[model samples]
Target: MRRFTRNAAVAAAAAVAALGLTVTQASATSLDTWTVTPGGSFTATATNPTLTVPAATLECASSSASGTLDTGSGNPGAGIGTITTLSFTDCSVIGIDFDVTTAGSMPLNVNGVSSVANAVDGSITNIDAHVEGTACSADFTGQVTGYYKNDTKQLVINDGNLTASNADCLGVINDDDPALYEAVYAVSGGHTITLD
Candidate 1:
């Protein structure tokens, strides 16, 4: 097996926008505060997330899943809550990151891929969080990293800094080799990405 690494700063910036996150400081006093919100239609982000596999297995459409899958923010009020969905059409690369502060450890199934429910990708770092009352708050203290490849049927995550607290209903929709969506990081503000 080989390893692929990208600049954390660059990837973070890209992934944030790709997922339709509105990066903003909590207030004037905050130096590095940011918030992620879902954007337009066709675009998909996370609020209430869900994952399901047909029967109990996921079959790859092609022989290889070693390419990159670009991500974008999904439309809001889709009745799917605040969950981001990564659709897969071609056997491309796919990875997912959750807002540690907003969404906490939620169940995940990578279909034919390996287990990542309790595993964090190594590519992600710099996460900070503190529990307040019954709620947990987190800051994007570090990068969120992971990888999803279909050829090897594997998903990798390596982060302890990020956090998520999704207690809402987990929604999972299945499609025959569906389209995979990844988080987006805005370039010089924003750009347009079509899933099809």
Candidate 2:
């Protein structure tokens, strides 16, 4: 009887996977494939983007990023695209002007499609951001989780995945402090990216 039950469970799991279902952390309802329409190079902008850590908050009046995606149908895998440039303008940390930039790794991925129509979940990996202020400074590195909507053309991020490293901020922002980058970027450019 034990052997029979175990084999049945394995068969059930295999059946689910054969349906092209992405039953990972994303969502059980999310399909395992993605379709990017009119894909290519694109640019995005966000207003009032903010990065909050246990020690301090870095807020910006505006932020901009540019990247590209493949044009056509494909599976949601790593390295879907790349964010070549990302910058934050008119930023301040604790009321002090700060210069913030994203560097190192920049890959866009589509990990899952939410049950909701036109919504896709993914992340930007290897995110390295340096914050420099007159009285505070720190470097954070990690990935940012976000969901992109086709109708709104927005990528929303509000997760604490970045870890502070090489801290030198006079205790304003310490090392190993988890940082949350929250923003809603209105994506636009040559490609009208859409998922199917």
Candidate 3:
């Protein structure tokens, strides 16, 4: 009787294991590498703007920027990528034509990702804008908060701030001052993109 009981218990355990009930695998799938290209042209505008140069306050009329978004093999919800060939156009200061001629890249990351919504909010950081004008040229640092929509393939920058040092500007304006200015940017031109 004792041998029979032991055998029965072992058989039940074996049956449970054989049914594949011991371990479970996750059903969720993570996104791999993907690239987003602009489908059409986009624009950005500055708000609550203040430009302190030589004690002069100015506001930015508008900003035109475009770039490609790339995510190199990682989870879309929490991943890091780069924006290449990012350019700015028609950014003015104090009613003067301010042009950003130097093209550069920006570091981007996604947070609070929602697969159901098909969207991800992120930040654009470490932006080095090489700006050139008739009177002065300078390198400015930019930070922005934006979102990406999977359905529309659009990346929008709703709010942003730009800062530049007197030294970075080559002593043209604000030669000894560093100040923060408001800016807005977007990218949505008949662009093409691939998600893998």
Candidate 4:
């Protein structure tokens, strides 16, 4: 496997930490653009929405990058955590819920990507999941869907619950029109959320 840039790797790592994906392989900076459908209902209180983009360019380069989800209102209560050697934990995961909705085009370089949410207290509930491998081609879609137990440090999923969705449009795209690359999405609506 080719070596990736430190910054890109760190950025990718940051996304992994935030999105909860354990990437075994590496790739170039994959671009992901999405838009929220708006008028959607969510029962989970989302906190710190995150998305990672590879630092490098192209699928052959072996780079990565990412960004966090926002309220479509240009406001993220707290920024997503960066990937580091230290096991960095989200400062306020104790009382946070998360939900996501994305629509647009995404092209990935690798075969599969993952996301994880671990419980700090070992008794609380969070969410995490890994996406299965898919062919590298246009019009492909795969979803790495699941929930984690933050307090319990465990993952509880129902039938076919761990991997909820999949498609070719899941990964990141390389070069696309500026307008096409633009993403719009939102993560909100949670019962556990407590307004300060």
Candidate 5:
């Protein structure tokens, strides 16, 4: 009787395992995969944008930035990509050196095909900015508006703006009051992104 019970238990366990395998295989066929190629070189810029701070508002006369896209994969409708090689130049912030750069890839939502009206919004963190040899960092929220030109294989970031506030701009300005010590930044520019 003991031997018979042990054999029955083993058979039941094997049946359950077979059922699980069949369910997993059925679900796997229903799943869809999407592959996104690198859209090539991308660039964004801002010009003479206003930055409002707790103490005062600062205006940058000229600011420009650029980056590139990385290869990605996801579902067909819900895919994502990243921006790499981000660099900023010719930025002029009042009382602060306009030297800024991104530390990591900026994420972008990937729709079926690249469209001009598609909404691409993300945040850039660990930004490195320098003022009079003093190094500081802050996070920036960016909104990019543009279209993907299939003819030219380029992604255009036109009339885009990036804003960051509540940043501690130490040694950039002389203020005794702590409330007036914070600084804000705004940059605007239009750039063309090349997709290969």
Candidate 6:
């Protein structure tokens, strides 16, 4: 009876080890590599994009962005891609029609990707935009937080760490005033990217 009990215990330990091994193997599909399937270049268009400062705010009806991401494999770190161009259209700043330009701030860094189900959390850093209106001008620069959902292929720019400076309009945007930039971009050309 003692011999039989010992054999049963040994078999149980083996079974547990095998199950652990199987689980480890199945979990190997982590975000180890990222691929930009159809193409590397992608274009994104936004709806209801807006930029707000303390004094003035611009509510844009339409916006668009274009950028490229490199094919990174095996534990991708920061700087995997960059946003080459960003444009805002049909914007009104304090009742004055205007447009926002990110001049000299092109190629914004695409920092890193966080693990999420069917989606990747993306952070777009180094945001700098120049807003000019009928009688006002300001410069906004800072980083913004956003996430790219794989299911909808939408990159939503919501909360941001932005600041305003060099205000000439009046007193709406002061030097070092906190700012917020918001937009929802639908990405295209780079179909269904996987960041894992």
Best of the candidates, lDDT: 2
Error of 1 at 107 (Å): 22
Of candidate 6, the 10-residue stretch with the lowest lDDT total is 105-114
Candidate achieving higher TM-score, 1 or 3: 3
Q: Per-residue lDDT for 1-196 in model 2, tens only?
A: 9999999999998998865454463554244455677778889999999989887788999999988887777545467688999989999987889999777649987776656566777888988888888867788898999788888888888664899988888988899999899999999853434444
In model 6, state the lDDT of residue 21.
92
Which candidate ranks first by TM-score, i.e. highest?
2
* Model 2 lDDT on a 0 to 1 scale: 0.80
RMSD of each: 19.9, 5.0, 12.1, 21.3, 11.9, 9.8
Q: lDDT per residue, candidate 4, 1-196, as tens digits?
A: 2355877898888987866443422222122222222312321222222222232111111112222222233221222111111111232111232122223422111111224332111011122221122331121123222333333322222212111233232343222211111111122332011111
Assess the local accuracy of residue 44 in candidate 6 as a C-alpha lDDT between 0 and 100: 93
Compared with the true structure, the alpha-carbon lDDT of candidate 5 equals: 0.42
lDDT of the candidates, in the order given? 0.26, 0.80, 0.52, 0.24, 0.42, 0.73
Q: In candidate 5, how many Å is residue 86 off?
A: 0.5
Better of 2 and 6 by TM-score: 2
Tens-digit per-residue lDDT, 77-147, candidate 6 = 35556788888889997678886899643433333454556666566777888888777778888788777
Off by over 4 Å in 1: 1-68, 71-140, 160-196
Show model 4 residue runs off by greater than 4 Å. Answer: 1-42, 56-140, 150-196
Query: Judged by TM-score relative to the true structure, which candidate is superior, 1 or 5?
Result: 5
Candidate 4 lDDT: 0.24
